[model samples]
Target: MSFYLTALLQGLCFSGIALGIYISMKIFNIPDITTDGSYTLGGVVTAVLLTHHVSGYLILPAVIIAGWIAGGMTGLIHTKLKINPLLAGILVMTALYSVNLTVMGRSNLPLVSISSIFTSLTVLADPNQNTGLILLVFVIVITLLIGYLLKTDFGIAMRATGNSESMIRALGVNTERMKIIGLALANALTAVSGYLITQFQGFADMNMGIGIVIVGLGSVIVAETLINWLRITSVWISLILVLAGAIIFQLILALTLSIGVDANLLKLVTAVFVLLIVSLPRLNRVKD
Candidate 1:
């Protein structure tokens, strides 16, 4: 309800996007254009279940599993069929539109009186107190846990799979498995974010996921640019950049919305942001 609390919720939105981008781009190197669809899939799953009186905790995992399947489908198509990774993602994303439509049984799903994670976790809080702060805390904790997971051996293998699948394979690692696993983890997180987004925003449009991939990629690129500019080279630094990028992305969106920016233009703005981040190194001619 308050300004600060709204700002925190906005920040958490970006944090979710950043974490999704990190998993798809950084860990998997899969260039997952399918995220946009998987995102909506999560929302649709949550909304459908919530509409059917599913428990909040149960819906969380359901949406996550739904996301995993969506992403893993892309991985399977790419690995088994040898489709171009980009094209594979596109195909999966296309299929998800219909799937999302089916999940909602038409177009969009609404959470009229669903109990969200925040509502359940805030029983002790003042009825008027800010719940966004509590929700933001959980988002931060999830982000930190994801970062820690990426540091473990499994995470190392996942990262390595992104850069050089052959190298990881030669090292006795199952690169294909890692790719599948990475997509599963990444999309599951996206799904959870979508689930949270639906609960937080109180509605889920079947098409709500459009442009989300670009937004997530933009945040990741912006974060990477910031850290690379500073010559930061640690995994921790990358994680920080991911979080920072997401926060900054949301701030930019909020600012744009406050200035009465056209809703459609926001998609263009996201594209431009990604272009800027992707092109900066070449423009400066000093990428490495």
Candidate 2:
């Protein structure tokens, strides 16, 4: 039960990444691999600030700004330099590795000795339960904010830019500008995951963001599956489904571990699981 509970907390921590991916991949139709780098950047920034005795709430803006800059760089590279979006993301992600290391001044920074945002809350007696409750609130607020954004005029334009770039451009919408802004927003959200996860795990490592985009991809794909199956057109309902997908993805992994799968093979399991999720829909259509 405790194990499953921990997974639930982790899924909540990862809500930012799922939403980020939904923006980049679902909204903008860009794979935007900058997620791996910006995520570590968030954790790096959070760790540095916390060790300096900065207030937890104060660190959020810093983290978001840092993420925004990283994402903006990728957008600029892709739009201004005429680079492929994937390559631009890869370039920024690679650069962020060194940036994260320089920010940390080491390979790892431990936060267990210091206070965390989770520690500040005292509503629940059990620390785990308290953390879970706080995370639930955090996820809800973020989801609501995103849902509202997607229903606005700018948001509609952003979605249209993705759905029909040529058509929107015909209407005088600068498709390139939209792509840049969309990527920037996506990575900023991704960085928040790093902020939350570093505090949750009580440490920040330079390598923490390695291949992390897969988690977001898996979650978004899971949500995408449901969105298709239910024909969900409401943006708010789709956002809620994305949150559910993140939780469900983590729970599946937890179940795998509980059934005695080798911990070292977990990545392999994740890969296979994602492949199945990605393939299943196509297989169903083919059968019909």
Error of 1 at 191 (Å): 0.7
Candidate 2: segments with Cα more than 4 A from true spot: none
Error of 1 at 155 (Å): 1.4
TM-score of each: 0.90, 0.98
Q: Candidate 2, 210: how far from true, in Å?
A: 1.1
Candidate 1 structure quality by residue, lDDT tens digits, 1-288: 253445457556556667877888877767888889988988888888887877878887788789889888888888888899899989999998988897689886767767766676775556324456665666768777887988899888888888888898999998877887778777887777788778778889988888888767877888878877898878877877887777777777667666787877888876776787798789888745
Please report the candidate that would top lDDT against the real structure: 2
Q: What does the lDDT read for residue 108 in candidate 1?
A: 67
* Predicted model with the maximum TM-score: 2
